[model samples]
Target: MSTATPQKFEFQAEIKQLLDIVIHSLYTEKEIFVRELVSNASDALEKLRHLQLTEKDVHDDNLPLEIAITTDDKAKTVTIQDFGLGMTREELIQNLGTIAHSGSKQFLKALGESGAKNSNLIGQFGVGFYSAFMVAKSVKVYSHSWRKDAPGHVWSSDGSGSYEIEEVDGQRRGAKIVVELKDECAEFAQDWKLKEILTRYSAFVGFPITLNGEKITTVQALWLRNKSEIKDEEYTEFYKFQAHAHDAPRYRLHFNADAPLTINALVFVPQENTEKLGFARLEPSVALYCRKVLIDAQPKDLLPEWLRFLKGVIDSEDLPLNISRETMQDKALLDKLGKVITKRFLKLLEEESAQRADAYNEFYAQFGIFLKEGAALDFTHKDQLVKLLRWESSLTEKGKTTSLADYVSRLKDGQKEIYYLVAPNREAIESGPYLEGFKARNLEVLFCYEAVDEYVFNNVREFDGKKFLSADHSDVKLEDVPQQGEALSEADVKDLTKWLKDALGAQVAEVKSSDRLVGSPALATNADKFASPMMRRMMKAMKKPGEADEPVKVNLEINPRHAVIKKLHALRAADADKAELVAEQLLDNALIAAGLLEDPSRMVARLNKLLESV
Candidate 1:
């Protein structure tokens, strides 16, 4: 202890209000105190680094530029020491005691004038040091100024109303904060617990970090480095460390941009989609950083919701954070960053698709749902997202995929629309009546198998100026297949169609002799222009129990050359009773093929009745 007089002061009214808010409601997580103190320590070290470059002398020139944290659970205390710029007796009074010198007066005044409008100014004040009271019963800061003549001092506070500063002897060249943990916060005094928090929130801090004399932040902040200089192994290690993932990254984008905003991003596409494995919905994992110091580990708006699968670090020097450094304050700036990152990732995907087809295909196989989502919902990048979409079409092999661009390349000379059909699988699609006309005309129909594909296509509507049409839609018009064999005469078909419509009654909107069906006797096409079989299923699944099923109205088209239609037509001319049963059976069969049959039991009973009659 030194024989110097002590200085004591009460906190300003604004600081008292600010402190009350910080202690009660500012940070949702109590663990943020570690990040706040570490950041302050880092700033102090940075000040000393700058001082050495410009000033004539720095006290203790041989001290290492690092931060060390020690924990003593038995003593219920944790201490964080740094060997950088330290505070003198006067600084201990000014920096820790009086609010007039703490740079928070301007921040409070700004907040008072702007009311709720200027909350973004909180981060510029550097008041993160005051967050220590959230978990501490009391805090003692011991520091020695970098100036040779300045005496060391200790600042003590319980964070209730006032603080004390006194001269101290034999202090080192940096600040050491000793926190007496409250009973509820005693977990922070354990070595393992402190290490975990440090790893999560402060791992990439520019200065070295150590716990209990062991270094913790071993990996470099690769996002800030030159992309070419980073090694493959380094990237893999960083990915595993940052994402807590086991498998290596399948793809990564390390880039820096300056124009829209200063951005340094290192994003990685994981080897697999965790959400695809039945895990809970993934939260945003891209950590936000400023000058290599973490601002947030899971920022909600850093990227679009469709990009939740990505994991890595994004360091933006332009981010304006709140005083807690836990959330972003500027929504517009965050949106701009999101746009830039999203566009870059999309451009990378395009290049990957061109350069590594097999790898890109594998990625699409696992995570294509997100791209489809972006295509449907993100208008600004809908065209790019659509380009990345893959599908199995008539031109591609069974398991292979094709893009819209490839589909366009294979289009017939005069084709004006892109056609697709939604079904359970390729086999179901091939056996359906909708594909017969397109197949006979040598036209390719893209197969959409996912439940959401219908919704996606409806929102996307068109791509490359070509409208997307559902092959099973009632309004789809196909050119007549060239004459192949003897067919029913026009008068015979006209009579047969009128009689069929009367027999089907309310089941169908229209009955006609089909030009679209090749081999099928009859097919049901949905009358609802916007709804497909898959969309109907989705709506039904989402409906509440006992809700009435949506009415299924379809257009029934008959193929004149098919054996079943010929038999039904001749039977109708002779036995009217049996012919009615055959006509109903034919309509049920068409409904089954169209996946519009809500009750298969009725179809089963009708089939048995027909069998008994035969």
Candidate 2:
């Protein structure tokens, strides 16, 4: 029955070291061992399939090309069996007991050189059979090579630096690895647990996986299929299954790229932004896969941080991964992949915005904040992100929005800058003094309602060679508009400004006659080149109390043509104290309108004094 007694062999030093790492430190999760083993099984099966295509006289030529996994809790063993290519006795010794499959010596040198996790590099080296040691008290591999003349063999090891290879008979077509679970690792021997692992990491594998004789992987990898052959209903079903949601996807990008890198990506935008509905921020949802096996479900840097809401799969055949296949070894290659995906997504957004206006508006209303975040922080994509940004403007109808490209389309001759104002809402901005200057000069002012919008514009700085200027910034100097009514004289304007500056003291950086205002009495403008009052308030809210806030100084622009300014100029000489009180009240009113005033106590007290004086 037996050709010989089991031959014992001591592991090479590098093999021992690798075994130690596998059992002790290689994987972050012991469940990952399931993924690694299944991956190796899949590889073996793939090899057999290729051999069948070219070679004749292959053994078990008609065996089903699939993987079967069984768990026996009573026996405390987990078995992964594949009906593909197997190995002979000499093959088992070389592929398992020695350093051949492991590239053991070079791998240890790589770990030392990187001084960090490089499973991405390890993946390039090869899959380890030693991963069985991670959870096994003892392991046995029963294999029969694809060659008809090759004899079956069993490789057994306790993972204590030595293993035994013995000739065996009646073994089937491929390899079957049985791992007896260690005491603490017994959970892996349960059918339910093995099924869960398979569903997560191996569900998209090229072959069907039968867990305990029941097929578990039923969904095909939709991303890998051709778009022309796929149906709309099929896409929606895949979206529902992959995203675990009942709602249909708002948008789906199924694309394949070759230049720069080979990529197959299928990304979806959910119908609703959960974060917009007051849920916690989403984690990165684009799962990364190599061939068909998952590398990471939520690769943090797979896409820019702003794309956390994207759902689907990204598979690259070119990834150079480490042995564990858990991490990427080449950081530059990873970054290039991310950039390619991001650029393609932006292009998709641009197309949708142009061709599907209503659908895009709905998507943007829910998830535009993320685009704003990208415009602000992801400098590489900022220009593209800025072009996709939309906002309600002074020129648009009440609730309607316009894009930077559209806004620039209507730019008047020699209009060298794009002006915007940050306020709480459209009504607040339209009814406020900031719009008066832009309206009188026939210039459009974009209405930025969200606090994040200001930060976005500040980071974007310019679009289409036009600098973004805040309508209320002291630096803004619009063309003077002609006045129809009698206005205060130059001398009186100068006197009133000097008196108002003295009355307001440190509160007003300077008081000057307005060149832009048409209706409003006055306006307060922040002296900071880019920081709006609302932006400062937002910053202050995020900072600790003891943190130093940037000092604020503002300019007061008094409309010379306004009746209140005329009355105040004369009233100052007739009643200095009353005029001074009115000036202080006016200054406080302007500051409040600008979203600059923090505590209203002084303004409230001064109002009572002004009413008494009246």
Candidate 3:
């Protein structure tokens, strides 16, 4: 130690400016000071570790590279110590008293320009240390250089305008910072408070960390580890910790990519979708990290909203963070990073569906809505998401599902469209009149039961070069199947259709003998190509009750060979009133089957009149 008076120096203009910005306006949370100081310590230790490799004459070579934190509530002070590359008197003045000579700033510029993926270096801005002044009344740095010939020094500052530095004795070859907390900021000196901050932001730091002599950084950074080296239990444990979940994850995707952006991601699909259980909407749980230090825990723009069900960590070295690291600086680069993660996740789902059909089906049963949402919304990843969609089909058992790729592979020769039908359930679809034609022709039709099914198909439109066609759509033209039983004459068929159109009035858009009806007497198809029956019903339900519905008109298609049509043909002239009543009843029945019937009052009265006539 030097037996001399302490040398006081005026603070550099830039250092004063930097302190004001950091303490007053830069950080959103005052607790961020803990993360910044700990990060700086870790960076110092990393530098020392590197020096150990090449330098033979190192000071304090036997001290372990670790960080220790102590909090004294009675004294209202917090002390953080690290056995790292401490600074000499001149270096301290350059690094702390002046912003221009900051060591971390130069390292950041050099690392960035070199495009190096040094995961260990996190101190990009050299001013992270000044964040302590946010909650500090005073800060003292006790440091000794790693060089054997250098003497120890202590720098003191109240962060007002100037600082004093003087030599000290018996100092270790590292830096120890003691922050005398302000009266209002005494919370930082509590054991529990510091523990919470350290676990959240510094749990994944490379070096060991202790809070009041107890190890707090116990959770490993599994995302940066090799996937093959990780075990199922380890991944499950990480999922539970990261997601704050009770149940094990249903699926986990751990991968690293260098292209497009250097990424280390570990994403998981939860055991169930809480949103589906009628809970509040889910938020994005996939936290964004850089170099193993968390940047944003719930970054909204990190993933698409539909993928809110996923939970995990995504750490990338390529992110360009602003000075505070509270938010990302480059939104375009952030978007690219998200796309990379999303594409990888969708690919994982595809692989799961192909290799583990039963398990994947179970996952789909719970999480399929997310995929459907992505398919219907996100255009960039829609093509990949479409391959993961599943639905029940006529060719599969009641509970079994088929993928679009599987359906396309099974398509009949020369077919150019994939057909689907939305109904209340499998039984409703199988028994409905619309499916009779497809079943009769031995063609498969996907059965969709969810309310969003129609909307999804409407947006997806096509897949694998084949257009999506609703089985009951008015524009649908199915190839003819062999006719069975006696058929009505063409003249009689024309007469019945014409009478039906006139007798039903505005209820019928057009009446025609059907090519798409078999084993069923008749069916109704939407006249508006854009509005399917299910979609119209959904829209109508969303409106206030008793709100008059928009006028609905459907094209009624009748099977000419069915006995009811033949009898109607004979009875139309025999009794015109009875025939008119029967025609109205037939239209009502078709509307009910199509899910387009808004009111049945007129049909109820007409039905009673027909019964009395009988």
| CA RMSD, predictions in order | 2.4, 2.5, 3.2
lDDT per residue (tens digit) for residues 162-251 in model 3: 999999999999899999999999999999999999989887889999989998855789999998899999999999899998889998
Cα TM-score per model: 0.94, 0.94, 0.92
Clashing residue pairs in all predictions, respectively, total 0, 10, 0
Q: Give each model's whole-structure lDDT.
A: 0.84, 0.85, 0.86
Expressed as tens digits, the lDDT of each residue in 1-614 for candidate 2 is 45769999998878888888877887788898888888888888888889888998888888899999999999999999998888887778777767675566666776766534333333321346677788899999988999899888888999998989988878888999999999999999988898888889987778878988999865788888899999989999989888998988988999998877879999999988899899999999999998778889989977999999999999987876656677576788888999998998999999999999888888899999999999999989988998888999989997789999999999999899999988888888888888887887789999988988878877888899999988899889887667767889999999899989999898888999988788878989988755587778777889997998766689999988899889999898899888888898888788888888877998898889888876
lDDT of candidate 1 over 179-200, digit per residue (tens): 9999999999998898888887
Q: Which residue pairs come into collision in candidate 3?
A: none
When summed lDDT is taken over every stretch of 10 residues in candidate 2, the lowest stretch is: 117-126
What's the lDDT for residue 610 in model 1? 80
Q: How many backbone clashes does candidate 2 have?
A: 10
lDDT of 3: 0.86
